[model samples]
Target: MSSRAFTAALACALLGLIASVAAAYVHYQLAVAPGYESFCDVNATLSCTQAYQSVYGRLLGVPVSVLGTGYFAGVLGLLLLGRRLDALASYLLVVALVGLAFVIYLAWATIFVLGTLCLLCLATYAAVVGLFFIAGAAASVPMIDLPSRLSRDLRRLSGSPAALVLCVLVIGATATSAAWFPADSTAAVQTPAERASQTAAQVDAEPPLTDDQKAQIRASFDQLPRLIVPADAPGASVVVVKFNDYMCPPCRQTFDLYKPIKAKWAQQAPGKVQFLTRDFPLEGECNASTPTGSHQASCEAAAAVRMARGAGKSDALEDWLFARQTSLTASIVKEGLQEVAGLSDFDARYPQVLALVKSDAALGASLGVSSTPTFFINGARIAGGMAPRIFDYLIEYELSKTAAPVPVQ
Candidate 1:
């Protein structure tokens, strides 16, 4: 290969190095920091935290960015060797190809399985591709000579004690960094007394019962747990409270099932049908009901909606966040806040609403909620999720019990 190819590969390696370092920062912010928000989380489909928290983010319990940093450093060292390393072109080509393959695999996993995209990961992939194609195009060695050239390169490197030492140093540095790398994605189980409360947990619910199902639910209504909740509209015939985590798939399903029914009540019954929601993120950052980091982006989602309510943008923002629930991250929640609610100060403003979210989860815990999509239909607690028609049924049932309207003086 030409000398220019080595120089180009060196540039690509340097770019990759920068990307790896950035990735390390992202990993640390997500893994350790509580409620840390990055600028890269665009949605449920484009969250850096979600991508890093996934299986592909590490290799055999070691952070992948640490490994990547080592790879780029070794590449830089090899290229710096210049003419001292025999068959340098062949070595560059082989190394670049291997790196490219791994990059492609990560890309596939991130997009296909994880269903998300991270800007940092993309940057690394770009650098690796640049290195691979640049080295391949600039290779002067024929493909037939690759095996013998590789053999000669290895022998030459083995003969040079300094080159061998370089390899060992690169490896040792990588191992040392990996050993010291932070990976505390776990959230606190015992929330601070100030952070937690004895307040009832936002209770969570399921779909329309057939005749038999209706009969069964009604028969058991007398035996079901009574969930006391603050009514949104005093004297309202029916009140429905949903404790939801935006990133929970079942929660999203519950939202989808209830959307139209709630909309219909908003138009028809207005004040009579009161539909309320509470934030109950399964994530550890601001929620106590479940483990920390359980839902990576849920705290942000909760904060966004709560903030949106003040701006009269809750409906739009909530819909947008729920649509992207599975791929949410703090960054993604910030994006939704800006795009859906025109709240550009998401990072700054979200903290103000976090307390409310934590309080809601604390309340849900006291009320015996342990999962997302819990519901309280006028003091009746139902864990898990149910259908939309059930809300209508419950509303009708409550309506039958409501006192007749009192005449205004």
Candidate 2:
């Protein structure tokens, strides 16, 4: 390609890299700084937050945007240095084509699977398309001594092993740093006093529930199906009910936060906490309240959990499912049931299991649950993800009402 066209390609790739970095920043902000409002979160259907937090947002625990940032950076480097390495430039064109294909798949997922359009994601997609075209143009430039040019470039690169190693190490370090340190470090440096103040502020910000409101919440909890409580749970002084979907990312986060608190309570005040999980699948296949095709595998997953519960393997199955939340599907659910619990009769029991799921979903819908991971503590609603301190406060508050001091854990 001409020098002018090659420079233009490099410029486009640079622009793309900038967009990827911006998306990564937004992702970090959303995760670490709760209630962050993004410019691209125009609505439910066009929310950048939803897209970034969804299952497709990450690949094998690393955020896709972080990977994109490194990818575009590498492409930018290759475009700038391609003049002296024709073979490398040609190979990058192939990489660009592969990247374009992957972006296409992500676009399909965003539209059909996620049912949302993240403007930042779309911007990155545009960059990839532009890079593919630019790379294609560069590759199309005919070379009289293509083979000889590649051979010479390879020999030159091989001869400078130290330089080559340094470059590889630099790229590897950058990618690793991006992945490991994606969140804002400042967010993690809060002092104990600052954290306590924040927790107190959050609790104070919420208006106290009136007696009537508390009674209504208690009645609502009493009406819902009571799933198995922890074997060692204390008496029902603090009944915690959760409406959760297996496919929901926030639900997974909430569960992770709750697990430790539940464990502590089980050790300290067994039988004092009555925790019940109710199915609230987001997919319309079993949950008539939800939009069709959204969270398509959720109903099946919920049924799988019910099957596990029947087989006395609910805890193991729940842990397994939550760990693999991003990849939950009918096949995976079946495999988990078979492998984790040895439920060979899943197919035979599926209909009964589905009935249990429907019952819970119906109960959730009756309680006005329009979203997953909704929580109720001692008949008072504690919606969305919360800090562990908040849960501790609520549990203590309930215990305080009874004239008996909570046993120290």
Candidate 3:
């Protein structure tokens, strides 16, 4: 084959590889940014948000795409300047084989696990295959020790780089097919019921909480004077202590469910139940539970809540925090605190109050509160912010224990 044709084929492959890198960078940006809409918005079954946030998205500590982008960019650069380097063909040949393996792994994950493929990600997969073909074809041109059976056949195919071009076309076709035609919607869609069933199946796989841990959680709730309840007249057999983050959206929703329960029990059956709110922000600046920062503005929110509690405006502050959660900036939260409860001087005492909030956060972490809206009801954990229905179920379950005493025959 003419050198010009070979060069053109290599350039086409390189173009695809570059496009892949660009797509990967876009994926990274989407993952880190909060306001970005979910890919599922296009179609509920096709949401990239769920796939990107899953454990499968990361490899060790780094993002999978970050590593893929770097690797593909390196391979493309090496192939582009292959003529200058000595023993270029041998090195390129080995790297192509390694690239082939990575492409296979990515394809498997995208197909079987991720369920929905980002169209651009599929383009990157095709680019890997094209790169391997071009590199292999280029390497075979200057053969050193050709095998008797395969060498002669490869010479014809490699001589014109036709085989490599054909391979690129095949990859492009495969990627196009995969992107345009998706699997059945039913096959891909995992409804709430299915997810609940899946969770039930995995429940037995988890290790049970230890006795000492249970006792510690129980002791923490026992210390609170008036634990949080849902209804005005709670049956009063059990006390629930909740550790929550004001800036957390889910935590706010959880409180919305809990507040009514508390009111119902407080009015109907007063001395029976109590509810207390503990500050547990999931931010690295304040909470040491997590090593990395999840929420940047959580520490300030915690402090504002604390100041509200101190000024005898706990209920008002709690309402304010939940209501104006989206605008929980340092200034806004402080201003709200002052406006709602006459707690002035937020700026003058910012440093000391911030430190105290951080200390409280650390203390919550030391007591095994890793996530927001964690709860302990009479020593039993009700983890994850379930909806009002779940709250009702728990209330009934607790009341049943009182009604159905063990028979002593």
Candidate 4:
């Protein structure tokens, strides 16, 4: 390739590499930082946050964007070597083509399956395509000659097995290091409790809502059904409303965390705390607001829970469902309803139960709840799953409002 051509190729590769790195950084932020909105999160349909958090975001336990970052960096390094490393550049073109193929698959998934478009992801895809053309143009030599040229280069470099082995080891080590050290490592290392505490602290720092906002929130709250709290419970001055999906992993985690806390509230403050659970399934089968296939069994489970509630076994069925969240299926849900709640006639009540589930979902939508495990403590909204301590803080804050001020002597 001419010097000018090579320079242009290198420039394109460099630009593409930078974009890949940026996309990877955004993916890392979405994964580790709760409530972190990217500039690319333009709307419900064009949200980078939604696209990166989907099940397809990761491959083999590693984020795909992280892999893209390493791939682009390797391509950039090969491009910088110029025509002297033409054989390696040719090999990298094949690698870039493979990466491009994967990018195409991800693009298809983002559009048709996930029903969202992540601008950052599209930028990475554009980068991969650019790198493919740049590397292909720079390495004009035919693929059939790649092996011979590479072998000749290897022989000329250090005609020794030790040198080749060392080179291979270096490449492997570099790739492994890139895989291990993703962006924002500190965020990954923080415990869930610490992250939750930080999020709650941020929420707490916000100015108290104006009277109009509080009234609006309360009016929204009145649209939902009260959860089945203990009838004889104490002051019950604080209402804790949770918008949750039965199949959501975080919702299960939050439920388990709140178990003991709920128990403590029942023991200490009785009627003071009223915990209401509302359905917000992310499956389109029943929830029109959610994209299809987001949560496969959520709609079914929500309907089953509604039937269980009619059977006066809401808590028992919820406990069983949350415990086996990973294993939930239509059959399991039906079996649990029959066994846990002794609702052998659940099939007959399917229509009624589905209606109730849809009602709860509509209520959640009206409240602008787009995620699971969102909490409203006395009309104060807290989105996302939180640490038990944060829940305690919220409950106490609500309790304080109900406390009678001391009479001035």
TM-score of each: 0.49, 0.53, 0.45, 0.60
Residue 83 displacement in candidate 1 (angstroms): 59
Model 4 residue 205 distance off true place after TM-score fit, in angstroms: 22
- Evaluated at residue 381, the lDDT of candidate 4 is 62
Question: Which candidate do you rate higher for lDDT, 1 or 4?
Answer: 1
What is the lDDT ranking, best to worst? 1, 2, 4, 3
Off by over 4 Å in 1: 1-212, 404-409
lDDT value for candidate 1?
0.73
Best by lDDT: 1
Instruction: Sort the candidates on TM-score, descending order.
Output: 4, 2, 1, 3
Off by over 4 Å in 2: 1-19, 22-112, 116-235, 403-409
Where is model 3 more than 4 Å wrong at Cα?
1-236, 350-359, 399-409
TM-score, predicted candidate 3 vs. hidden true structure: 0.45
| CA lDDT of each prediction against the hidden true structure | 0.73, 0.70, 0.55, 0.68
In angstroms, give how far residue 211 of model 2 lies from its true place: 24
lDDT by residue for model 2 over 1-409, one digit each (tens)? 6677677777777777887888888888766764344667654355676677777887776777888887887777666555566455465667778889989988998888876678888888887787777667667534455667767766776676654665686489567756675543222333335434544554466675656655554455446553432222355677888888877656765565567678877787777777788888877778777764367678888888888887799877876776665456788889989998888777787887788788888777776677777776655554565656556656765675665767422
Measured with C-alpha atoms, the lDDT of residue 300 in candidate 2 is 80
Candidate maximizing TM-score: 4
Predicted candidate 1 versus true structure: per-residue lDDT over 178-223, tens digit per residue: 8988864543221222111211111123333578766665667657
- By lDDT, the better pick of 2 and 4 is 2
lDDT of 3 by residue, 158-235 (tens): 654545665565456434533443221211323335433433443445455455644554455346444333323255
Give the better candidate number (1 or 3) by TM-score.
Answer: 1
